[model samples]
Target: MSQSTDFDLTSSQTAEFDLTTVAFKSNPYPILARLRTHDPVYQYTSSPDGQSTWLITRYEDAEIVLRDERFVKDKQSTLPPEERAPSAGPAPSVSDLFDLGMLKFDPPDHTRLRKVVNLFFTPRATEQWRESVQRISDELIDKVESQKRMDLIEDFASVLPIRIISEMLGVPAEDSMQLHLWTKRIADALDDPAAFEQVASDLQAFYTYLLALVEKKRQASTDDLVCKLMHASVEGDQLTERELVAMIFLLILAGHETTTNLIGNGILALLTHPEQKQLLQAQPELIKPAIEEFLRYLAPFTITTHRWAREDVEMRGKLIRHGDAVLVSLAATNRDENKFDHPDTLDITRQENPHIAFGKGVHYCLGAPLARLEGQIAINTLLRRLPAMQLDIEPEALVWRTGSTVLGVNHLPVTF
Candidate 1:
């Protein structure tokens, strides 16, 4: 990535480049491209709180931030004593619920939490679910096969992962829809900070459900990931009640949400790029690499969760002060001209692809293998079963979900 000695943020550009707006979420590439070229380390101030966050756009800079130890995930540890005081509130905020997960921790603690369930998500272990994933995909398609038309996201993409993860976590089949609703609201809150209060009730209900589930597991163990975690330990250190609840919460939300986007975005890519779609149909062997292409061309998580500067740091001549929020744009880094040739083009058969859609470094997504398995089976089964599948609505008429953290369509209607 080329270094930019001068930073330029015109008043007009600043006004138009607001990241929180629906329009920006719908299409952030053009603006991200401009930032990558001019201000690789741009500072964006939130309109509501006026808190500034440094945005890392270029591939080189993004890699540095992701891998560097100085950019920590736990901001509470680095904040000054005065700023660290807990805010008085009637109930815990949605952000508080999120901070309990492993995603919000650094090594040692993060390592310990991940180690308890790491065996379940390994590449080899994930293969065990291939048949289960295929069966679920077939069953989902069977329901809509005769309908001739269906909302792909609602009827398929979203359902497949939730069912799989629910089963893995030993959650009852009947409760899948309820869990889905809760996770969706939590994701929406993460996307739009303003929606936190609106979704607090749902979040609390979800938390209560998890508490009950944990207690039930304690009395009776089963051969499921959740049960295994309840007994599994590293160096004879077992997970506490709070740790267990947070672990299960993270697994449920991250497991299905990211894969849902993977399947949704992957199918959308194929629908728009006819040639690539045809190529994959003709050569089924390309499904694995095609999934990688989808992750690259349209990353599931556009920008990473906030990482705070442990201390004053300089990158590309920009100063990121201690305790300041830093975010790495995975979407921009994947499309960096310096890394991938013709970065915007969708090429399923491309031989040289190294995208960080699941992210990189210590915090790399643990459910990536499962997500790839689900995407491969879901996309391939859809193509094989409904060979004539096509978008039911005009491409431009589709509405994108608010917020840039996760990239996906709200609903994908399709016809066979």
Candidate 2:
């Protein structure tokens, strides 16, 4: 790793950089760069809960933590008996509903849960949805084309993936907005603890809705993905009722959120770099590589979901004790000076790209192929149809959505 004398953050200086701040969320690259350089394994403490989490910033160290089996996802399993006591009340918190999926498990359980739906998300299977994705992208643009000005996020980026995923999961198109609202609330609660009480009703409503949907699928013989999951059995083991709800919940949230941000962020990147946009327009075949570049330049997922240390482990010069939470900054790692040349530059034609935007190891995103397909189709369709499209507001004036795991603008106002 090369050392730079330009900027350095001492341990004390690092503590001042809160990850949850709106400023950090809007532009985290500068802070993350300093962390990677001065403190690769930096420790961050949340002011709300007084819980400490180790932030792994460098590319190599982040990869190590991701691939290392010692660093697990199930924090409960690693907790001491005293810390694992059951709650006195039965009220469900955001974690109760959101963390029950495969993303929160490890080993046999994660493997089993993932295997049940693995085939549905493979590259070949995802290719079958290209026509549907193209149709949805076109329809979304067609609605706004006549208007000449539209919030790209509200009208197009956020709607396309939800529609496709809803159709695949047999969820009614009418329920997409409600589901999106519930998912956003859940994510907000996770990001800001104080918001939990306000969104509790939403959490319960979402859970109840999914439960009813599962039972509905159970009674009828449908051909959607939900029906297939209901009947899918791996090694004579079927998904339990809770598991089914959790799986469906995970699919709905993960299915659209990442892809939504990808389209939004990718468009913004191209709009800011007009040359790259023109490059893609001149050679439409560059869409695939351009999508990859967008992901590398600005990953939709800024940091990974928390991973817990099962036992005391050391990375770099810092020690992460047992039961400690660790977060790998995918956004930071993608821009590591050692990983990619001109890491900060937006180069659509660059070839040596190896980004872990969807994550790595066993927990690598299952819907990556689908997300890429949607991004390619969405961006290509927009450029082809709206040749004069440009950002309506200055880049700095755009408001980025906060209190969520996904990194994207709240509204991408654009005009052609």
Candidate 3:
């Protein structure tokens, strides 16, 4: 059934949008547009906080909210909770991510940290890693070359980026494999509130683990980015130890999480859409466009730009109260009717996507270039090298991640 036809929006409970709407999570565009017709900026009830927040579904409206100064992206600017949020649960990795370094700060701090990160991850910097990325992609593929069946998630996507990040961070190239457990536990916890508590514990453990590594990087300096960050000054100011750890955590998080999802989602999309897959096979030259199309099609980030309105601001006729959390729905805006000619169709050759997959404005993703290079090289290599690769499991047999605001897949069993 169509996402719109699946719902009875007139019902009182249904009128108040809940995140449980599977259609909204997996494919929310139809319902989002239906609601946008009357309330482009609707108040959506979030399961995480158990409160209502503004949600913009239209491409134009969402863009305005993302770029506008009135809606503060920093959560600290909001009324600090009546009390500090109860931290008693799984790992509180996201909270740590924003608080530890650049992700948390506003203007001067945000700009400073971002500038430092950009120095190493910029497009030119990304080009420097092209050969390294391609080598890693080719090497990883070779591992599963003869295997008739493999779990693409763990065996491939999950491992590749993390391995590179470990090396890039001046991390002992061999011990990078250790980050595997930390990334997984932290990623899983972000979705489950119960898991979130565990995340707190895990985060402490990760900190202990990284503390040693940071000390090591400090002692044995090299020319690598991590070493560079160790000595680099931001706007004539040096990063404190606390700030450095946060920066490292951000690198590992971005390095591993985003690209893993990007590849997983891209692989899943190709398997599901035979036409698009065949199109890529027919014209290999379209890999660049196809990669962008796939990222737009997958859209893994689940509203990273969560904010609280500084004051009551009207968005598309909706009253956004002061101090209300505003969650930007990227999946909704990417498919907005006004944004694309054929919004839902998997058009690999699509041009002018300019989707918010990497986010927009000052808060835009710093690792986009690296993610793109990794994705383009990875996807192109997989297509070229694994010509016989096809899904080993049935479509119905697949299972999606739980409470993953940003998701790819749990497993993609494929055969060569």
Which one wins on lDDT?
1
Model 3, range 1-416, lDDT digits (tens) per residue? 11223234656436434443333355555666676566667765555556666667777887777778777756656666684443212443434544756755667667877777678888888888888888888888888787767888888888878887886887776777768767767765563567678678767777777777778777877777767887787668777666677888878976688899888888888888978888888898888888788777777665554767877887655578888877777777777778888888888899788888887788888888888888888887887888767898886667665443566667899987
What is candidate 2's local distance difference test score?
A: 0.84
lDDT of 1 by residue, 1-416 (tens): 11234765666666656655556667788778988998889887754667778888899898889989999888876887877744223443334456668888898778887887788899999999999999999999999999999999999998999999999989999999899888877786674567767888898888888888988988898898888888887788787667778788888888878999999999999999889889999999999999999999988877898899999999878888889889898888999999999999999987899888988899999999999999999999999999889999888888877665777889999999
Locate the minimum summed-lDDT window of 10 residues in model 1: 86-95
Query: Residue-pair clashes per candidate, as listed?
Result: 0, 0, 13
lDDT of 2 by residue, 138-174 (tens): 9998898999999999999989988989989999889
Candidate 2 residue spans exceeding 4 A from truth: 1-16, 80-96
How are the candidates ranked when ordered by TM-score, highest leading? 1, 2, 3
TM-score of every candidate relative to the true structure:
0.94, 0.93, 0.89
Of candidates 3 and 1, the better by TM-score:
1
Residues forming the 10-long window of minimal summed lDDT in candidate 3: 1-10
Taken over the whole model, the C-alpha lDDT of each candidate is 0.85, 0.84, 0.73
Arranged by lDDT with the best first, the candidates are 1, 2, 3
